[model samples]
Target: MNQNIFENISDLITSGAFLEAEQAAVDLLEEIESKDDGSQAFVIFKFNVAGFLVDIGHALSNRGYALKAVEIFESLEPRIEGVIDPHQYFYNRANAKCHIVEQVSTFDLTFSSIETLVEAKNEYWKSIKEARKVNEEFPEQYVNLANCLKRQFRLSEALWYYDSIREMAPEIPQSWINRSEALLMLNTVSNSYSGKMLHEISSGYNQASRSKFLPPDYAAYYGEQAERFRQGISENDHAETKKEFEELSEYRKYCCRSSLTLSEHGLYCSCAGAARDNLTIPLAATTVGGAFVPQMEAVLNRLKSEFSMARRCYFEYTEAEIEIDLIHEECFTDLETNECLGLDFEKLRTAFRLCFGVLDKIGFAICEHHSLKPKSGMVYFQNFWQLDRDNRREKFEEIKTPGLLALYSIATDLNEHKNGEWKNFKRLRNAMEHGFLVIVHPGSVDDIFGAYELSGDVELVELDVFEKMVEQMIQLTRSAIFSFVFHFRQKGLEESVPTGPTVSFQRVNLQM
Candidate 1:
């Protein structure tokens, strides 16, 4: 008999007889963990086994054991996620938890899942953290941050950020709608103030919005809110503001404290007497942090049926990490046909903005072309290069923000060309940065076109599906650009190294 259990279990872990393989593997892990029995390499190997256990848990497809797998991964993530490329693996762990959440949603689970946008909040923080370090997730991070803030009811600050993006990427239509939302909010808040305050804030914003493009109903809506704001403040009553602040504070406290959410967030804790009630069952004898929940098994099964998904995502991320341009050359989704783009500071702030100038005009002439001028209140994002910047240096960043805003203003002024409306890559910039872009001129074409089309018909609530599509496009575009830019970088031509573009883009214009 082989004394080395890991070696023997490795041999036994085939597609045949998964239960027996699982038990043997568990026994080996137990034995090895007891002594300082392996080198650092061996410890790394154990993590791989643990990740595999996660994979196996999915293969079993038993809901009763779902919580068990969640416990195992949650524990391993702190330890193992760091052992390798932590970002790649932690993202996987997050996805796994999300999968559990999605599955639980399908069933009448013990913990009632609320409509609170907690996962989106967590994701927003993670993306923002990434953006701060690399400046890679600018547009997407900005948009998501704006959305999360809106959800948390920070209307004023959210409006400021969205306004900056419209100046930066004016061609994107969603920014317009987003701006309108915030303006409308301010319009309501203005009712509490004197007419002078309303006149002051609404000066530039109101004039820019009066082009007859907005539907009559929406225009009137903005008017009503503005008028309401003027009435409330002169009387000096702040009941609305105080109540809103109080509610928002509670939301923040709930989101910030992990302890408050962990129990409900976890996959229905067995310690809560779920097993004895027969509310849960044992689908497989999986060791999950000293307890078992049947859904652990079910969650695992779901993951296995879709196991190639993790590799697929990593593969995509690898490709996208290459360049800022060529984003449209990538895949739209694992399944969709639309092309998406990614932008860096230089191209987005420079070349990309050049494209939006023409698109903005096209956007205004709704009858002339395809346009999705971003609604002002939506979101705008840009990433900074290094997260390691100290507080003093960070304060410098705060100071630089005004300069950034000024620079954007200059760019908007430069766009006063009254030629035929030309839609360049501005929409692509927003799509790359914000995940939503103007697909078609909402007023002109019946369908909206974008780097990725978000037709009103389809919904993208799950990050796995959305991320996979985005990452795949990012990867495909990156790979294509890297090979081309290996020796040279140009827009339409790549001659030396040969490969097809990951995605395709078309430059269209309509006379203003």
Candidate 2:
């Protein structure tokens, strides 16, 4: 293998040309097969070919091409095994099997013990030794070996791999970032890797992992998404959530009766791919410029129905402007999770859109005045409460706070009470903002868990965060409005100045 051709193959594989990558692998293999199979060039090409195949397989998996990835991994297994040791191919082969198992409805994965996984994992690194014996300039190979070892509970070995790579990776300085990430994982060795820690990984390691795993498809734009389903309590969101939940629940009864039992074992979904349709959401809100008073009022009414807080709350959505104190300003925060609700909306919007689609195909928009791009009669506010993946509504029943919704109830101080009227919106927003968008699907014990998260984001969060936020925001709003009214009345400005909802709607032209 000429050094130039070897480098080209590396570039192509890293660029995600998998078929081309396979052909490149075969080219290297054929050259070695016909002449000098044990030459220096043969050794270099075999190592390059095997490494490329594995990288391509990883790329395929990241792109959601699971079967394709499995095929790539499987195809490379036999060829690479012959050139390298059996240990080298173990990790990719195991990962391929794991992905396949993950997709199956029933595969009896318990039969595949962790010990077997570890053995395979260990072999994968052992092959790296053979590859390095041929040519040792490859820094990423060491990092890859470390990551594979780390996945199988081999923290020390993984760290050794990363540390070695750190020493060897001067050509690729990003390895320090990788080193930073691998170090962080050590902290995560004993603890759960979710919530704040998950954010750290996505922001640091996951982001770095993307560059390593799929250089061509590294996600460039990401931030936290707000889960303001409590805004569902707002008139617009409330009306939307209520109407949507009832309609979906009613439809659920019919769908439940329509279950189709599989010929093999379990019952097939009665939904004629309603789940598929739900994933492809469509937005229907009309965007016009300025005077989006009606939209705000509409949302406010629904929020009023859903939320009651202790402090004056402000709900902020970005348009051309940042702060528009028309309906209300939400000083939204998950006191429990300590998540801020005032992050950028664009990143969070995608998450809401995803969660909305998960909720029976509803789409959402946070229109500023009439600045919604196109005009339409209906604006489909996204419903995070939609149940599909695993009967999330049933989970909601299990996690609901029965007494908090009452006219007069004091449940904020209670640690066990399940109410996230405040925190859910903020935390969900935070999670979505950061690229972990699928949490809004309501397959968990709490739908509001999508908001601020509860127990654990991977589990659940404190109900107090939600309850207190709601309680405080409501009290604040009432007080703020009362002060506004008294001052206006005292100044005699009430007669001449505009009175009523601070934000009102009017027909306005959309700039975009």
Candidate 3:
């Protein structure tokens, strides 16, 4: 087959000749698959077909047929799995999916549309990892990834990516523009109302307007918005303005105090009085038909208890010195030499396990209280927000609670991503549970001896890396707990007044 035929197919798709392009693509695919020629020319033909498929996908996407573009892109995977590099292929599909969210719709609560967007986000991550493997910066992919996070209402996570893009490629206008949008959304949602924060948002728009490719009207619109933000505050007392903003930001407060207690927002308080400052729940002692209060308290308190135990183990590990006895040294030594590679510290191990363990506990509590019923008897943190275990977006349509979106973001943190650290934490947890996990000092291991014996049964992590992972696990668990509590507060704020008679309750404490 002539390569001109592939070009013709692309031309057809580009010209909006959909019916003709479909027949041409179908005929070419059949002709290519039917051929079994033992020649290099045949392999080249397959590559051409794969490229044409990608072109068609892009053409469809450019024309606003994003879902169709997704199907077209997916069809290329099996055709050239081992022959062609898939980084660009993954990127194009991600762009198409993103277009669906931008131009089409997330369908709001519809699971399929939500799945498309989430898959697009994950695909962008995969593309980023693949680009890094080849030493490519792929800054646009980073922006796209951040855009996905922003769409999911994950402004903080999105800001990191946008900020990184600005650092690495300052000329990219989208980075500044999107970063400003994210910051503005954060300030608005949290009601920080700080003049300094608004000024930063204003500055970002002005900076982005410097790009030559930016439309004059678009720049003008943003310029007006920026001026509006700037006019909100006087150009004096900068320190006080920034201070007031930081103090009013609920997001910043939760983040700064995450390590202090899991109940920084007080949703997990054991008593109504303790929760009054942050949340309000009726108490059993003063309200009629308040048995449900104690039951809910038991559930929340159990989660608090689990998190506190993990925090204590972490604290002990940080404070205590390693006492290496002769037997312990022998068990950890790679050879007869005195150098020890493996760390068999029980406190660190306990903290690692407990941190990961509490995620499932928090998941169960969220599902039970938020009325997100699971399809299966088994529930895990990663699967808490979805109806199906394999599909992360299966329950997006079902999430009515405002703060649960944030909690769902926590679940995504635990999910496996290409070149992601969270996956390593999860694998280490699995190794501890079902196999062998060794925390080794990288310096103690000899290069001459090779990295390790060829055994699939054990997982080896450097001591520094393991310690970092333990710390991350603790923080992750804490964030999930905070999100869980905030879910109720957000719900309480959203719900309308009760139509039925309601009881008033007072705080009571028992003397032990």
| Best TM-score among the predictions, by candidate number | 3
In the range 1-512, model 2's lDDT, one tens digit per residue, is: 47787778777866657678667766675675566444544544554554555555555553233344445445545455346444445444544433332322111212233223333333443455455556533565565545543343233334445545645564443443444454354333112222322332343433344444445344232111112111122234224333433444333423222221110000111222211112100011322222323443344334332222111111222123454572156565543333323433332343233322221111122222212322443433222322233454345333222110110011111111223222244445445444342322213333444553432434233333333333333332222222222222222221244333343223221110
lDDT of 1 by residue, 117-221 (tens): 234334444544444455454553455445444433334335545655656765443354455554444333222233333432343234334535443544566
Q: Work out how many backbone clashes candidate 3 has.
A: 0
Better of 2 and 3 by TM-score: 3
Model 2 backbone overlap count: 69
Tell me model 1's lDDT, rounded to 2 decimals: 0.34
| Candidates 1 and 3 compared by TM-score, better number | 3
- Model 3 compared with the native: what TM-score? 0.61
**TM-score ranking from best to worst?**
3, 2, 1
lDDT of candidate 1 at residue 43, scale 0 to 100 = 48
- Per-residue lDDT, model 1, residue 21, is 62
In candidate 2, position 476 carries an lDDT of 24
Candidate 3 wrong stretches, greater than 4 Å: 1-63, 78-85, 102-110, 187-189, 234-355, 371-377, 385-399, 409-425, 441-457, 462-486, 498-512
What ranking of all candidate models by lDDT puts the best one first? 3, 2, 1
Cand. 1 TM to true fold: 0.25
